[model samples]
Target: MNALTLASASVKSRPLHATLCVLAAGAGIALLCAIFLLSGAVERSFIRNAQGIDVVVGAKGSPLQLVLSTVYAADVPNGNIEADQAKRIEHDPRVAKAIPLALGDNHNGYRIVGTTPDYLSLYDASFAQGKVFEKPFDAVAGALTHLKTGDSFLGAHGLAADSDDIHHYHAYTITGVLKPTGTVLDRLILTQVESVQQLHAHPDLGDPDAAEDLKISHEVTALLLKMKSPLSIMSMPRQLNKTSNMLAANPGYEMARFSRSMGFGKEVLTALGAGFVALSALMLLSALASSLAARRYDLGVLRVLGASPFTLSCTVIAEGMMLSLAGAVFGILAGHGMAYLVAVNIDSLQGLVLPQSFLHFGALDGALLGMGAVTGLVAGLVPAVSAARTDIAGILARGRA
Candidate 1:
């Protein structure tokens, strides 16, 4: 018989042992794959959010908190800064662009950001319907907001749909709706800074045209600043912290430190997974060694049928590799399935959107299959060598005696 037929027969003869090796290796690969997918997605999201904005200037607080709040919109602001203070930074020679973030009100849990039209340029946003906010109380909805241009919604006092403080007096008109950009902006409600000032100043609204005279405090929650040059980071951050009362944070640095802090647990899990893979190799070796003892007579008969020593050795090795291939394939599928479920739940509750690449496996996954095959080949080596040296003539003579 050919080597393929021999290898198939060997695995078919011992199903339980084969399954044990596959399951162990599969579990290890599954955990690793899931980690790879999740980490890549998270890193990409952070990097994308921090693009263009070099410095985050806000009231003195946790630097990490400032970065998270301004960049990711996942945290509360660190107190407000004077509108004049932010404008001073905007006109500074070292600053390229400055977008003031005025955050407070929300509609049905979606945050309403009070900023100028320049904020839309940060995400390269284009209107899918209508134009930008032209008048007070006029709003531009995100693509995911499910609101059309003419639709009007009451703004909640806080960032919660179920918030107790609801502004029943005023209804904000959606003058525009942004196209889906796959960024955090897809979940926000954008309106003129004047609209937010009006929302807080007047609780009881009358007419849109008549309310233009009302005024509120000139304060912003934070400032997103971009530098004119790479060299500006060193002097500007220090100056902002030392000379000014506000805090400045570098998102890239904060994110790396945060990732390092979170990495300890992931490293431990990886070590455990490696332990399982090693155990799988051991089990495969033992199973192959044990099988050789019982299969010597069959192997000798094959040798008598004109199969060479090398062919017999390769057959045993192929059987082990086949088991590895099965395990690797199973592990990859299981890992991605878990990631998909997780991404779905996160999107449903949290506004963080994972990219299309997160759901797809790349070259590393294919490399895992090859790695598994190598593992099996190493485990089956000693047993294959023993099988190749089987005494054909002696076994036949003894059986006939």
Candidate 2:
């Protein structure tokens, strides 16, 4: 038989052991691939949420929290910046646009954001149904929002899926639903800033200056700032922190800081994954070496039947490659399937949407698959050498004995 046929028969002879070797390698690859997909998705989510904003202006607090809340809608707002402060920033020569956000209250777990229609452009979002909110109590829903256009519901006091304190008296009607952008906006409820202000307004509620200009009485959770020039990054945030009551946070800088803190743990996990891969490679080597020992007599017979020593070596190597191929393919599928399952479950329970980012194979994935082949090559090398150098006379004599 040819080398490939011989290799196939040899592997088939020990199907259970071959499968075990593949599974060991596959398990390591699955862990590594899943981690990569999750990390990549999270990083992309952060970047997408921060797109087009040069700085975030909010109350003095954790800059990361402010960005996470205002940008990603994943946390509570630190505090509010006055309406006049947001307006002043809007008028700054260096500022191109300042999209204000007023948050608090949720419709079945989705955050209700009070912002102008300009907010849609920040994400390059388009209308999937109906139109933008034009008046108080009118809402433009996110793609994932439970409410459809023309539907109405009273929002709860806090951003909880089920909160006890409901705004039972007045109802907000959904005016539009945004096309899914896969950003924070995908799950948020958008309305005019007035709608948010009205929700907080009551005869008994306290305010520092309740009688102030009704417009000035409004307060926003944050300002999504755009600059006229890239150079403004240096001056804008510094000026805001020094002169204004609001704190200015650079989302890019904050994300980088977050990445640094997360990087060490990421490295540790990666090293652990590499270790597993190495261990599996060793297992494959050991299994193949033992198989080669058992098959010495059979391979010697093939040598007598006109098969070259090179053919025997190649046959053993082919067996190793077949194992690696099976492992790599299975591992890739398992990793993505795990990601898909997590995404669906997370959306159903917590509403934190994690898309199947692993489905898109990139250089990282290619390298991961390549690593399997390299492992096979390393594992197969010693066995192939031994097969090439096998003592045909000795094996045959021992077999006859």
Candidate 3:
């Protein structure tokens, strides 16, 4: 019979051992694949959303926090800056464009962002249904929010969906719905700056003076700025942080630092995956080596039946290869399957939505598959060689020992 047929029979005979090897290898590959896919998606999302914005200015606090809250909408803001102060920065000659963000309330779990129409242009957003908010209390829902035009909802006082502090004073009407841009915009509810101001202006509903005072002294959570020149990037943030009460953060720099901080966890996961793979390889080697004793008599019979030593060796090698290849294939599939699960459920895990492209298999996945195949070949080599140099005469004389 052929080497492949012999190998197939051998693997089937030791189903438990073969299955264990596949599971071990699959566990390792799953960790590595999930890390690669998740990290890549997060990096892409950060870069895409941070584009067009040069500096994020918020009340003095962590630069990273400012970037995370204003640019990614992933964190709570440090504090609020005066509207007059933000406007002063906006009119500066160094500033190309400045968009003020007033964040506080939410409808269900989605944040209601108060900003000008310029915010839509920053993301190159388009209408999936109607138009942008024109009057105070008019709103634009995101594609993922599932809120249709003409629907109205009361804003919760806090960022949490379950906040009991609801602003029942005014209800926001959805004037438009934004097409999916695969950015933070997809998860937000957009409205004019006055809408958020009105929602929060809890000015002792009995006092007109309190209401007027709030309108005149409005505060915004953060300012998203675009610099007039590349030099402004270095100058503006430094000048603002040192001279003003605001924290100025460069999105690119903060994100790079965030990535570096995440690298340690990724490295730890990679080490664990490598360890599992090594353990599987060693298991494969031990299994093959131990099985040789039982197979020696068979090898002797094959030798006497006109099979050359080279043919006998190939049969042993084929068994090792089949087991290894099966493990590799199983590992790759498990890895990607884990990644897909993580991607679909990312909202609950991290409060962020990853794009569908996160599940794509690329050249890196192919490289990983190749690495698995190579690992199998290496693990099986020594066992194959030992089988090749079997003492045929001794095995036949001793019979099936």
Model 1 agreement with the true structure over 1-401: per-residue lDDT tens digits? 68778878878877887778788768777777776677666766677777888888998999999888777777787877877898899899999988888887788778888888888898888999999998878899987777899999888765666875666656899999998776678788988777777676666545342232232346777888889998886689888999888999888889889889978877887787677777777887888788777788888888888888998898888877888778778777777876667766675423455444456778868877887888789877998999899888887787732
Q: Rank the candidates by lDDT, best first.
A: 2, 3, 1
The residue-level lDDT of candidate 3 at 265 comes to 91
CA lDDT of every candidate: 0.79, 0.82, 0.81
The residue-by-residue lDDT of candidate 3 on 1-401, one tens digit each, is 79789878988988997798677666777677777777776777788888899999999999998898888878888988998998899899999999999987799988999999999998889999989999999999988888999999988765787986667678999999998787888889999888888766764455434544365338888889999999999999999889988899999999999989988998898898888878877877777778776787887888889888777777877776777677767766677777668866667323244445545678767877776777667776787677777787888887786
Q: How far off is model 2, as Cα RMSD?
A: 2.9
Each candidate structure's TM-score, on Cα atoms with residue i matched to residue i, is: 0.87, 0.92, 0.88
Candidate 2 at residue 393, lDDT?
90
Taking all chains together, the TM-score of candidate 2 against the true structure is: 0.92
lDDT of 2 by residue, 288-333 (tens): 9998988888889889998899999999898987798678777777
Model 1, position 176, has a per-residue lDDT of 94
Identify the superior model by TM-score, candidate 2 or candidate 3: 2
Sorted by TM-score, highest first, which candidate order results? 2, 3, 1
Best by lDDT: 2
- In terms of lDDT, the poorest run of 10 residues in model 2 is 208-217
Clashing pairs in 3: none
